[model samples]
Target: MAGDKAVSTVSKPVMRGLLNSSIKRNLTVALTLAAISGVAFKQLVGNERKRKYAEFYRNYDAEKEFEEMRKKGLFQSC
Candidate 1:
């Protein structure tokens, strides 16, 4: 009975250590993934803003072209 008790005590600490190690590893992976996702999201937002700016300038130039057309009497104004 005494030998069994000693073995059980030793096993308990070993089990606890294993559990702690597993938890630490999982937390490290989660933090790494979160950082990677944040960086990717920032890049996507930057690219989207650049595309929108380009589109806005294209539309603005088209309007200027129309004004020039009006000046040239390409179509009669209402």
Candidate 2:
């Protein structure tokens, strides 16, 4: 009686199709986004500039200001 049972093979064509389409869709979306962001960065975002505000200290008159403050008796220990 055990020899009367029928056996069938299982095929996975649906899974293969789904995985192939998903990879293609994801790759296309990523490439499109990267291209758009690259164009925006190069054309719309422009260049970057870095400057130091501490350089303003080089233009200060420290000795003259100190002499004026001393003459005006602005320093308590002077």
lDDT of 1 by residue, 24-75 (tens): 9999999999999998987999788988999988778777788889888899
Number of the predicted model whose TM-score against the real structure is largest: 1
Candidate 2 backbone collisions, by pair: none
Q: Write the per-residue lDDT of candidate 2 for residues 5-33, one digit (tens) a residue.
A: 66656775676579889999999999999
Candidate 1 lDDT at 15 equals: 62
User: Candidate 1 deviates by what RMSD?
Assistant: 7.6
Give each model a TM-score: 0.43, 0.39
